[model samples]
Target chain A: MNQKLFFTTNILILTTIAFVSIISDIGAKNYTYKQVNASDPWARATSKLAKTGAVYIKNIHNKGKNAVKITGFSANIAKKVQLHNTVVKNEVAKMQHIEFLEIGPNKSVQFNPGGLHIMLMGLKRPLEKNSHFPLIIKFEKLGNLEIMVDIKNIGWSQKKPSNYKHVHH
Target chain B: MKKIIYSILIILVFSALSFGVFFISDHYAQKWQSNKLFKAKLYDVNGKTWSIKSLKDKLGIIYFGYTFCPDACPTALNNLTIALEKIDSKKLQFEPIFISVDPNRDKPKIIKDYLSSFDTIILGLTGTDRDLKSFTFNIGATYSLSREDPEDENYLVNHTVGFFMITSKGASLPIPYRNNPEDLARAIEQIKSIQMSNSKFKKISSIF
Candidate 1:
């Protein structure tokens, strides 16, 4: 009886560890977003006719540990994928190479156009107007989630209509 | 015989004066004219004519290239965009202007659309191919075209990368010589310094 009880305890401990591991892996939120501070964010393409599409994903919400991983994502039209950041050095905007994103604890990160963005480089063809590209985002812990991004023309703003944004000279 | 000799002497004097003036002008133009970015009439992407002189107080970054450029032009533009962020808005301002060297393919609409991707302030300008070549060559600029794909109706254009920094008073500072990012930044900084100094010598004497 004693032997049987010890064996049962050992099985329970092993099962608990296995279940925790599985939960952590599957619980990772992939491409999850929420409001940063406000809904309005600056996003624009470098050209009205650029073969590329960039959007500002702001007020991102990726709480808890386990550095968020974004990979295995494919766009229907984009030939290559990259995350590009425009860092200011000596008052000049320089492109920096980035790989993954990490939002620690309650902190959030924003990917604003002309600043930091995920460049869908080398589009297989021009992204047609009125059509959206589905981005398959994968996370190490959360598995996979997909987001459909709208390709807006140059000078596009997420701000509400009837708003006149100032053009600073 | 005396009358003929006197007339010959007058003729010799005039010829010498003309030669002296011609030599000085040519030397000045060759040394200083090519570096200045002067204001001139340019066609917008909509084919409407415009000029940088319209922005009298602001400085302009004038770049010459085609919309169909595969890589360098866009990268240069991107670098310029990055470089502009470093400028202090209160002291000086830099506006980027895209001048299409290939007028055949880069129409007003195409140029406008290409420039629209960046900030709204960036202007896109183009003109007839002949006009573009004439204007570019006059500045000692060089460019060439190569077919991208014979199979396709559309083709690519390859050209030199050159940008001019023109101020409101019509003074131009040719930068990068060939579109190097470091050179661009240095040129902008130099412009900013000149503006900050509040120097009286803001206007250029020659136009290339």
Candidate 2:
């Protein structure tokens, strides 16, 4: 083989290897979750006809190095935005706040009742039953995702928080 | 045969007297529970009115504190939650309501946000001073504001540390739970037993 042709072939092989490795990494760094409707997201599970006052964002698994960024919460229904969790100690019910939702590579995040859920504080109007609300959830790497959450009936007795284990009484 | 009949009569009289004494004591105890309650109206985060009356037919566990309270409020609330855990769920139906004595600092949104940290069912109530004083006095709960520090806007509030477990009909549920896990568990067991007895009586009456 000519000397010039040999050098060119070596450079071509290196470039191809680099390209394959990049593509493989991108494939391994994706996260997926089961999409959830706003109705019966967290608090709704306590009763069948719970008011879907809050939007449900479920199956929030992320496979990346950075934490997931959830923004663009402004909407007509809720006046304020917050993250909420229910923690039990000495048999008392306590509500907590979380500032960030951490998502690691090949790791997932959950926003279910009694654990971690977005609190849609200060509802501008009553959450009508069987209605749907559009929520825009943004991820740092994924950019933006849109989900529609359905409203369920309010005051259903059977639905409880996800972490609530029924007592004998 | 005459002597035997006289003895039987005496025994019957003694039984009746004992029953009367028992009934009177029980009635007095129940009345005491009702008289021990304090009055206060609670407001939700949205400034909606929340009264203890609405939770009738259920047990009410109420605590008075502010969101800006440094330590006592959170610690007491946590302790109450722990006590609830020691209770048998079947025996008691209760709700924990948090009333902010400091309405100026603890707004509806602030109370709601701060209360989100616990794992229990807590309702934050805040209202006008007159309303708070009357409610506190009626419920037998005492609260006062501490001096504010210029360094921080969050001030401290000194208040009572206890919960009232009331029945669905606005009567006392007779909760003798203490801070200890074992004692709390025992008290809860007794409460459940009492509820069960009452329910059994109801069922028997219905059948008759």
Candidate 3:
């Protein structure tokens, strides 16, 4: 009886150890999964007369193995969407369409004003402030992920120039 | 000695003639540009015909862009608005005008709505391609539509982003103000100087 009791206690301790290790492994995996997540997806409110608007997304990839490539994107807010980069040449601004954007391992890509942005053309309706819309981002490795873009005020992402001051009389 | 003297005399005469021609041509070219700007007709957001004369007595910061522009147009317009607000418009009459390059999409109503988002004082203008061409040519502005299907609504327009300062007399000032608050302030100072010179000229003419 004494031997049986000792055997039973050893089994219980081993089981507890195995369970704890498994739990920790799962936690680590989840952390890795979240390392390459998208954050701060936002769009600017558009006026009724505006036919196009831009969407910005911050893509972060923390993994050191595979580089994440954003292949395409889609949204119900517009008839068509494309990736575009604003190029300022000779102080003249022009938009250049790009095929795909790649975020290398342990790197991040920011889609912001005066830089890479998702151009939504032929907007079905004006994007109002405080509203949200669905955007599906397709990736080369991770497949597709649906994100909700928060619509903010027009020029929300614009940083006021340091010397800029509004003088109102 | 006689031959050398003749050659020297001929050279001097040619030099004087070239200088005279250059001076006259430069003067007339400047006059023509200003006259063309005054005569060029454009349609305001109200669909009413307006000319550069309509903007007289006010310093105008004119820019040409499309409504669909995402970054540059808004940045430029916003900077202009901020600059305008910083100055005392009552003392120095300053007007901001946004001319649309995409006239097909930017109707008078559309442009009016777009400008309202920036500032109420801003005047939005749109016109046919021909009208725009003449006005832009006179003002030394350039814009081109991207190559896309005629029916495609996703086209882009490449345009010059420099703000053309139009003096009160409907002439494009030679000073180039890239869309910034500091440059705009500088432009304002230059405008004031021009105004002073004009007033002095008027006073002299009155004396005459």
Best model per TM-score? 3
- Against the true structure, candidate 1 reaches a TM-score of 0.47
Per-residue alpha-carbon lDDT of candidate 3 for residues B1-208, written as tens digits (9 for 90 to 100): 9999999999999998897676667556766777876666678888898777776577677889988886668767776776676775453577788999889788888888887776437788877898788778888788889857988767799887777777655556544645566677677667667866865654444432
Q: What TM-score number comes out for model 3?
A: 0.74
Residue A159's lDDT in candidate 2: 29
DockQ of each: 0.13, 0.02, 0.36
Task: Please state every model's RMSD to the true fold in angstroms.
Answer: 14.7, 14.5, 10.9
Residues A1-169 of candidate 1 have per-residue lDDT tens digits of: 9999999999999999999988864442234443112122222334545555554554455565444545444566666556556543332334444666554545555555434566665556665544556765555566666665655544343432243221111
Model 1 chain B: lowest-lDDT 10 consecutive positions: B199-208
Query: Model 2, A10-101: lDDT tens per residue?
Result: 99999999999898643422223332112223222111111113444444555555555554454555666565554444433344545655
Candidate 1 chain A: worst-modelled 10 consecutive residues by lDDT? A160-169
Q: What DockQ does candidate 3 score?
A: 0.36
Please give, for residues B45-142, the per-residue lDDT of candidate 1 as tens digits: 67788665666677777777776543345556766765676554343466778888777667677777777655435788876666666556655455
- Give the alpha carbon lDDT tens digit for every residue of B87-121 in model 2: 63443466777888888877777777666655566
Give the per-residue Cα lDDT of candidate 1 at A71: 47
| lDDT of candidate 3 at residue A77, scale 0 to 100 | 86
- What's model 2's lDDT at B173? 48
Question: Which whole-number lDDT from 0 to 100 does residue A8 have in model 2?
Answer: 97
Each candidate structure's count of clashing pairs: 13, 49, 0
